[model samples]
Structure formats: C-alpha cells, structure tokens
Target: MSLTANLMKTGDAKDGAGSEFLAFTLGSEEYGIDILKVQEIRGYEAVTRIANAPEFIKGVINLRGIIIPVVDMRIKFNLGTPTYDQFTVVIILNIGGRIMGMVVDSVSDVTTLSPDQIKPAPEMGSAFNSDYMIGLGTIDERMLILVDIDKLMSSGEMGLIDKMAA
Candidate 1:
C-alpha cells in the first residue's frame, strides 16, 4: 500500500500511535516487528554453517551475490528446538545499512497498531531482559510483542552483523 493509504488506515507514526508491524510466530507466541525495517520475506533455505560462530547465528545465505547472516530467533530466545518445515519463513531486515535475516516459525500479516493500543511490557524478572522491546501491542484479544529489530540486530552479541557491515 502507498504511504498515504497506510497512514490513513493505521494512523500516523510520528503524531499518533499508528505504526505498521509485520507479525510472525516464534514457538507459540506472536511477535511484531516494525514494517519499515523489513526488506523482504522468503521461505527458509539451507544455509552454510559458519565455523566458530555462536549457536544462535545459523550461518549465512547467499542472497543474490551478498552473503547475509541468519539468526534463529527460537534459539536466541530459548523458546525450544526449532523445526524447519515448508512453512518456515526468513524475514530479511535492513538495519543501519546492514542486511540480515531472521528465521521465524511462520509469518502472519502486517497489522497497523496505534500507540494507544500498545502497552508497556511488564517486567518478567531481572534475568529476563526487555531492553529490545518497544512495547506490547494489543489488537482485539491478541497481544503482539513489539521488538526493536534494529537494536537487537546491532547489539554486541550480534557480532557477525557488525563484522559483515565492516
């Protein structure tokens, strides 16, 4: 959809609580990511594992001619063992001019959420970090955990992304 149309449907990102999010599933939970950061969505493909890389970093995939690092959200979040099926999806994100891919269980659809509908994420515990969370968005009875993909992708733990960008 065009920018004007999107704004009309979802509201204004700057002025109001309106921002579009790409909803995806990880385990049994629903998560939302800023639509602006999403470059493309593709089906899961076999990736070449990287040597001496973190377990969460599932290695790289050659996109066109560029090899982009892929991270498994299930492993990163300790959700459980992830199974790659025909329905698995890879969300390609462009953050800070660097491109990376995130493996997700399945992608639903893009939903527009207003700020008023999003509530602050509750604290789980000291061990449970919510630093990368933007907030919790509510749509009807479903709650979408909004993530700051840019922050999560550029974090020090995501060393591969930094190395690739350099």
Candidate 2:
C-alpha cells in the first residue's frame, strides 16, 4: 500500500501523510517534538533540588502525587546562560512509560508538516549529536529543528528513567 493510503487508515491523517509537532523556543532557535508525546504545558514551577545530579537535571517536582524530573534544555543543549521570565514553561512528556518535564524558553504553536517539508539533519561532528533529531521542518519561512522526544529522554545522560531497568 502507498504512504497516503496507509496514513488514511490511521484516521488522523492530514493532507497526504503529515505529522504534528509541538514547537517551542530555546534562545533564538525553535525546536519541535512529536505532539503525541506531550502530556501538558505549564508555567515553570519550583522543583526540589536533587543532590549530586547533573546540573541539567534541575530537580524533581511532585506532579499530582508522582514525582517527575525536570530538565533544563538550555543546559542540555549548551546554550550558554539561561534566564527565566514570564514566558518560561515546562513541557511535560510521557516517553516510554516514563514521565518527565522539559524546561523551555517558551511554547509556540503546534505545527503540521507534510513529508515534503521535512529534511534529514546533516551529520555534525562528535561535539554535536543528531541521534534525537527527526529532521528540519519548514513552515513558510520558519525552520524548526524536529526532535525525537522518546530517544532524548531515554538517552544515557538522562539516567533516572533508564536506571529503573537495571
């Protein structure tokens, strides 16, 4: 069967095989994650600091009885200094049965992109890993760095969730 026909069977298919991404801002660049993985978006909140954890792992928050680790994207992406203001928000994600929160500069709109609008991320050196990159998506004049949220969360650096299997 063709890609369009396969997408139509899924029921949520858009004009010819398209995917939805939740776009957010980090510094001057915009990034997107699979919409299905996002649980909710909330204003940045205080988290209980964890001792000896990586600086990127800001801390944990009690999210309706369940504690969830919150990661700062600025630190993870090596985006220099980060500042929190009225626009800062935390994106709660449910990836591979694990729940966590990602702190971003601001939340943008959800964008739908067809296959024609996506391009593979070019291979960078060891200092830059593109393992979690889905591709670069174009919407009008805007370019979004698409991310694979599941792989990012399960990466060895974010060890809390993966530690459970050990």
Candidate 3:
C-alpha cells in the first residue's frame, strides 16, 4: 500500500486523548514523532551492517546488548543522504512492538500539539510524498511536520528484522 493510505488508516485508528511529539531537524525541515513511541535518544555510533538489508537500513546497533536496526530517516523520507558529523544523533523508537533507531541530523525540542493544532497532511503531486506525515503542526512561528512513526516504519516491512532478532 502507499504511504498516504497507510497514514490515513493510522489516523483513523486513534480516538482521542491528544498527542505529543519530539521535534527534530533534518536538513532545513523540522519533523516530529509521537513522544510515547520514543524510547531514547543517543549520540551516533558505528553500527554493524546486516547483509541483504534494505537501503534505508543503516545497520544494527547493539544497545546494551539488545540489537536494534537503525533507519536513516533522511533516506527513508527521500530527504537525500545525510552527512554524519558531530551533530548526528540516533533517536531510538518503539513502534508496533518493534524497536528501531533513526539517525537524524539534530534534535530540536519537544512540543505538544493538541488535536486542534494538527491539520491533515496536504496532498501535493511530487516525487516526494507526504503520506507519512500525519499533519502540519504550527507552534508559534515554527512548523513541525507531525510524523506517524508507526506508519513510517511500516511494521510489515520490518517483520523480517523482527524475525531475525527473534
């Protein structure tokens, strides 16, 4: 299925109670993810590559002996390849019972967006799709691309990694 269809499905799954996001930056754009799914954030480190893995999969990192696959959000979001340097950090997130890490350029600050503040993602015909984006959050003058990490991960696609780890 397409990313937009997946996001629409996820948006419909949730009833209420509001949601919070941890904002971060990749290149010039700002993005956010549900805070409840974020496990932890750590500095970038060398990871062990897995054979025959997806291009977006950076590799597996042993986080205190629990191996977790890391995805380069830059590539996954079609934001292009990221130049890793001192500012790079890994945002470990748990989505749909799977633990994965995403390498981001840098992390901004956490922001809360009530249901009212979020507007459904805008549809634009282009190479880069906005299906993973749940909505656009406006806080003050800054715009946060509220991302549905679960949909972004596409749990079904990651089932292989989970099976390997199991």
Candidate 4:
C-alpha cells in the first residue's frame, strides 16, 4: 500500500491513537508535520535560483514538468550554515492542492502520537514562530516540535503560495 494509505489505515483505529506525523530533522531539533500533508520525500538536489527571491527560498525545481518552489528550513529558521549531504532531503508536500518542497536535514520516521501526548506550544520569541506550531509532541524521551505546515507555507511572508488559493 502507498505510505499515505498505510498511515491513514494505521490512524483509523478508534482507540484514540490520534494523528500520524512525519518526523524530520532541521539541524539538531526534530519536528513533525501531519503525515497527510506529505506527498513524498526526495534526496536533496540543486535548484535553479530565482532572481530576487528571498534567501530562504533556495529556488524552484522542475518535478516532471511542474515547477515547484523549494524552501530551505535551516536558512528560513536561521539555524546556521546548511550542508548538503546524503542525509539531506526535500519533503514534497501537498498543501491546499499546491505542491512544494521543503529542505530538511533528514527524515526520521512516521510517528503516531495520542492526543494526551501533545502539549501546547509555549508562547516564545524564536526564529521559528509559535503561531505556526501545532504543539509539542512527546513520545517517550523525544520531544517533537509539531508544525502546522499549511499555515507556515501559506503565510503572507512566504509569497510563494498564492493568496487566493491559500
């Protein structure tokens, strides 16, 4: 079965398993997003830089004739210098019918977290805005920064996503 379908099936249990999230790393921190938003994961590749585009927006990549904008999470969050290595990956996401790629350090795995395991994101001043955070997910000893990918991607500042469709 497709990963999406499989994950959906796994999450379908009425036992209150809550939602599934695709976990990925951005620097040393781990983050998670709703697995349903993820279309696929791909190895990082060179992109054609857009003239005058924001620094965080690396550029666009032609995926089977359709050009999709790729955003570098490290640069966008001011994590530090980003290195392109075998571990680097681009998470292709389908947000509101718009396909886009997000560059992350690497993908770990899909995790299932119950509602009780999620805690509200603390209001704080940081490079990554809390407004776009779903909450903090705790699984054993690991704490994942749960991101609201749709909100972050369609925010006014990104500009890459069309406002009308967002």
Q: Give lDDT per model, in order.
A: 0.84, 0.82, 0.79, 0.86
TM-scores of the models, in the given order?
A: 0.87, 0.86, 0.82, 0.89
The C-alpha local distance difference test score for the whole of candidate 1 amounts to 0.84
Task: State the displacement of the C-alpha of residue 122, model 2, in Å, after optimal TM-score superposition.
Answer: 0.9
TM-score-better candidate, 1 vs 4: 4
List the candidate 4 regions with Cα displacement exceeding 4 Å: 1-16, 161-166
lDDT per residue for candidate 1 within 25-107, as digits (tens), equals 99899999998888888899998887778888888899999889999998988888999998798988998888899999998
Error of 3 at 136 (Å): 0.2
TM-score of 4: 0.89
Task: Per model, state how many residue pairs clash.
Answer: 2, 0, 0, 0
State the weakest 10-residue window (summed lDDT) of model 3: 1-10
**Stretches > 4 Å off in candidate 2:** 1-16, 161-166
* Residue 113, candidate 1: alpha-carbon lDDT: 84
Ranking by lDDT: 4, 1, 2, 3
Segments in model 1 whose C-alpha atoms lie over 4 Å from true places: 1-17, 126-128, 164-166
The prediction achieving the highest TM-score against the true structure is: 4
